[model samples]
Target: MSDAPREIEALIEMMAKLPGLGPRSARRAVLHLIKKRGLLMNPLAEAMQAVAQTARECLNCGNISTGDVCPICTSEKRANGELCVVEDVADLWAMERSNVFKGRYHVLGGTLSALDAVGPDELRIPKLIDRVTSEGITEVILALNATIDGQTTAHYIADQLDGRVNVTSLAQGVPIGGELDYLDDGTITAALRARKSL
Candidate 1:
């Protein structure tokens, strides 16, 4: 039904499959790419192709890397006895962007989801336990999202690591610069419970 050429339509269809992009957005993006082919599309295609060839999961921490081990995992400075646990590579990248956590990370890949049949074996949990012992991790910081499945996964990990290492979770409460009135009851309750000396 599309009046566009078959090749252009195919490109638009492929773009539409990306997250947050619909058919209309994909059409617009495809058109933009076509218009800016010389300036943008060629470079983008080359970069994507290069990344596609080089991108691989780090064997140590499950992070996307161009080599066997990511720079963070290989860095001596990152071996600070604290291991930050995240659900996915994106979470790890976000933490890296903040430049706050000085320790290495363990990406679980996903949380325990009964509906989706996800379990410890499905994630990198076994690898996490192995690293805890092998790397002499003193504390494991759970930075999972505040969701039902995320909490469930955190509890499971805590139980698994109960006596071996100290376990902690990221504080869940009102976000920075967030108005109390705009927050939900759960956020208000958590903020009140986690109240600190001001």
Candidate 2:
């Protein structure tokens, strides 16, 4: 039996289920939190509770927001006639971290996955098309991952918006310091296809 109290062990088990954390890591984390209960644990618990109560998906863009519409969708400065489509809120957040794109976003929730029985109707694809029409979006940038499912979703979205708006995708490429020898054939081919003049 676990030496930890029932509640603490339960917390550790739940934490272990989180991405990137295993049982050992979760145990360490729980110990650290217990040690810093007054400073870290209480505040974290309160914050998580607050977010759990208020966090909701944006009605317009499918982004996680405390309000019905996320701040990005409501911001006047972000209405730049461009929409970046991503497979999930995590991907959207990654793009936001770059701070390069000055447009709004459409979180698809997930890519169309035949294996998992995911379809366009299951995602926010219909809402994306509606947004393109209603928001006067002139360009749709597909910033999906390079996985097969991601590519399939991108192609499907492009076809759906064929004549409506300019559809583009993030360039597939070799990383800044990547060695060609270490790359896969698909990466090399994609890089060659996306080659540009110096």
Candidate 3:
């Protein structure tokens, strides 16, 4: 039998399931939360509850937002006729942190994968095509990862938008098999500035 109470054990188990936390880390975290219940735990719980209740995906760009459309999608200043496509929201957030790309973004949610049985329909490829024409997009910058699946998805999107808009991919600074979310702000800025046609 575990020494910890059932509720605490359960909380630890759930926390362990998070991206970087394992059993040991989760146990430490749970103990810390219990000690700081009044100051940190309560506020964290309330924040999580509020976000769970209100957070939603943006209908137009697949970005996470509280409303139907994300702030970037609705902002007049972001409608610069340029669209930066990323495989995930983390990449979008990374780009935002870099403050390099002023144009709007299109989050694909995930890349196309034949091994995983993920197709264009499974992603937001069709919606991206629709957005290019509907939004008068003059350029589409693919900031996808350098993985095989990411490259494959970029090529597919390029073909889909061929002859319609100027399609480009991020420059060579991005390491092979590296994800945009892991890149530093300066590298992202440099890559965006040096982007070339696909």
Candidate 3 structure quality by residue, lDDT tens digits, 13-121: 9999999999999999999999999999999999999999999999999999999999999999999999999999999999999999999999999999889999999
Writing each residue's lDDT as its tens digit, candidate 1 over 25-137 gives 99999999999999999999999999999999999999999999999999999999999999999999999999999999999999999999998999999999999999999
Off by over 4 Å in 3: 174-198
Mark the regions of model 2 whose C-alpha exceeds 4 Å error after superposition: none
Runs in model 1 deviating more than 4 A are: none
Worst 10 residues of 2 by lDDT: 1-10
Candidate 2 per-residue C-alpha lDDT over 95-169 given as tens digits, one digit per residue, 9 for 90 to 100: 999889999999999999999999999999999999999999999999999999999999999999999999999
Estimate candidate 1's alpha-carbon lDDT, on a 0 to 1 scale.
0.96
User: Using Cα atoms with residue i matched to residue i, what is each candidate's TM-score against the true structure?
Assistant: 0.98, 0.95, 0.88
Span of 10 residues, lowest total lDDT, candidate 1: 1-10
- Which candidate has the highest TM-score of all? 1
Q: Which 10-residue window in model 3 sums to the lowest lDDT?
A: 169-178
In candidate 1, list every pair of residues with a backbone clash: none
What's the lDDT for residue 4 in model 1?
Answer: 100
Clashes of each: 0, 0, 0
